[model samples]
Target: MKYKTICLIIFSLILLQGCVAIQSFPTVARAGDTVTLALGSSDQINIADTTVTYTPDGGVAVDLTSNVRSIFKLYPDRASPAWSFSAASGIPVTSGHSASVDIMVLDLPPGLVPGTGVIRVQNNAVYPIFSDIPSDADVAIEIVPGVGSPAAFAYSLFGNATAGNFTSLEAAPHFRIKPDFEPNAWYQAPTYAAAELTISGTLNAAALAATESQVTGQLRIIVDEMPTSLASQKQVSWARNGGDITINYLSPTGKMAYYETTVAVFFAASNYSFTATPNVSIRYFDIDGNVVTGPPVFIKSCTNATGCI
Candidate 1:
C-alpha cells in the first residue's frame, strides 16, 4: 500500500507495557536509500537506549542498536534528538509530567534487497519500579527493485506451498485500485486490461527431475476487490518450464477501490525433492506495460515418500 503520510501503530509491551509509536519514511524504498524512523514515546521514556532489529522475510534478525546515528540541535529552541524534561536532564519530579526522548536516526544495511523487511524497536532502558518501559514497535516495509532493476508495483507478494496448496499471507501488500466512481479511472474499460500480473520463478534440480522437467498447474488468485473491503477470486492455468516459469495474466480490476491479491498454484507430482527450495516472485504491469516488482517467496519441497507437510 502507498503510505502518503505517516502511519503510526501503537503497541504496549506485555512486560513493560508502555506506548511506543514508530514512523518510517519512504516505507517503500530500494537499495542505497536512507530510511529514517521517527519514534515517539508518550510514556516519557528515553528512546536512546532502545534496541532495533531488522529482519527480512525468510531471513534472520540482526540487531541494529549500535547503528543509531548521533545528531545535534538544528536550532536552539529545538534539538535534532531532543528530550522533554522538568528539572535537570533526568526524570520529572512533578505529577502528570515525565521525561522523554524522541526521534532516533538509524543506519540501515546498504545492500537492502527487494522484499518485505521488518524493523522492530524494543526499549532496553532499565527504569525504576512503576516507571514506563515502552513496548516493542515493529514496522514492515516493502522493498522494491532498486534502480536499473524492474519497476515495481505499489504492492509486493510473499507466498509458500503448504500441503501442495500455495497461499500468500494476508499481510502481503495490497493490490491498489482506484475507485471506479472517479472520472478518468483505469477501471473504466480499456485501461483495466493493461493491468497484469506475472508470476516468475526458477526450479531446483530436484524439482526438475521430479516433474520430468515440466509441470502444469492451476493458479487461484484472490483479490481484495475494494481497498480493505470485499474480496474477489479468479482461477487460471500456469505451466512450468524445465527449470523456470513465467506466466502472465490480465489482473482483476475494480472502480473506486484498492485491490489486494493472494495466489495459490497446484502442481501434480508423485514425489518431490527437498534438495533445494524454489524461489518465486510476482510482478505487476501498469496500463503502459511498465513493470513493478516485489520480493520473492521460497517454497519448501517435500521429499518424503508420503508427501509435503
Candidate 2:
C-alpha cells in the first residue's frame, strides 16, 4: 500500500563532521497537503540541536529550526507558501541511539502555491552545547496545484457483540472487526473500494451536538499503525445517528485522504443507536463542494439483538 507514484527523494551530503541524508516522502505533494521530511545521520546526531531551513524556488531561506523560532519570528511556513515547519508536530528527535527526525510539514487552508523548494539541515552553532554535527544536505520537493478534495475513502467497521451491556450505545466499546475475533461481525462487500481516511483539524462541536446529544468526543486517525497521544484526539462527532452514521470531513482543515496506505479510524463518540446493524459512511468533498470517493461505506452487523448497532 505504498504511494509509489510519488517517489522518495534522498539527498546525501558529506561534511567534515559527519554525513546526513534527507528523505522526503511522496516527493511530489499538493499545495495544501502535509509532507514529511525524514533526516537521518550516519552517526547519532540529534536534529533538535541543529538548525533546519527551507528555501523555496527564488525565495529567501526560511529558518525551520524549532528552538530558534522565537529569535527568527517564525510561523508555520509551509501553510504560507514561504515554507516553515508545521506547528502541530514537534522538532526532530534527540537520543544516543537515534539519528533521525521526522519533520511534519502541515498545510493550512489555501496552503503554499505550487512550486519547488529545498530543505537543508546543519549545526545550530551555539556555545557550551557541543554535539554531533551533521553535514549539509538539500532535499528537493515539488508542490503541485492543490487537490481541494479527498482522493479516496478507506475505513474499518467495528461492532459491539453485546449491546445490552450498557444503557446506551457509544463508540467507545466498538472494536474493529478482525479475523481473530468475531470475524462475521465485520463484512466488506465486493463492490467496496477502500481508501485512507484523513481526519485532521479541530472538531465541529455545533455540528456534532446537532447530530446527537451534546455528546462531544475526539477522533484519532491511526496512520501506519502508529500510536499518538490520547490528548491529540480532536473533538469529533457523527453527522447523524441511526442504523447508519455519516462522518463528514468538510471542516476548516480541508485535509484529503492519502492514497495507497493502510489506516485505522479510532474515535470515542456519544450514544447513537441500539440497532442490530451499524453502518458508517465517511464522506469527503472536492473543491467544488461535490462528494469524492463516492463516500466509502463500511458496515458492522451486531450478532445480538440488544447489541449496540
Clashes (N, CA, C under 3 Å) per candidate: 15, 6
State candidate 1's TM-score.
0.30
The candidate 1 region of ten consecutive residues with least summed lDDT is: 71-80
lDDT: worst 10-residue window of model 2? 89-98
Q: List the candidates' TM-scores in order.
A: 0.30, 0.28
lDDT of 2 at 278: 30
Best candidate according to lDDT: 1
Tens digits of per-residue lDDT for model 1, 170-273: 11211121111222332322222222334334444556665433444322233321121112222233455555544444534422111222233333343432
Off by over 4 Å in 2: 4-19, 41-52, 63-111, 122-135, 147-309
Q: Identify the runs in model 1 with alpha carbons over 4 angstroms from their true place.
A: 1-19, 42-48, 71-101, 126-135, 147-309
RMSD of each: 21.8, 22.2
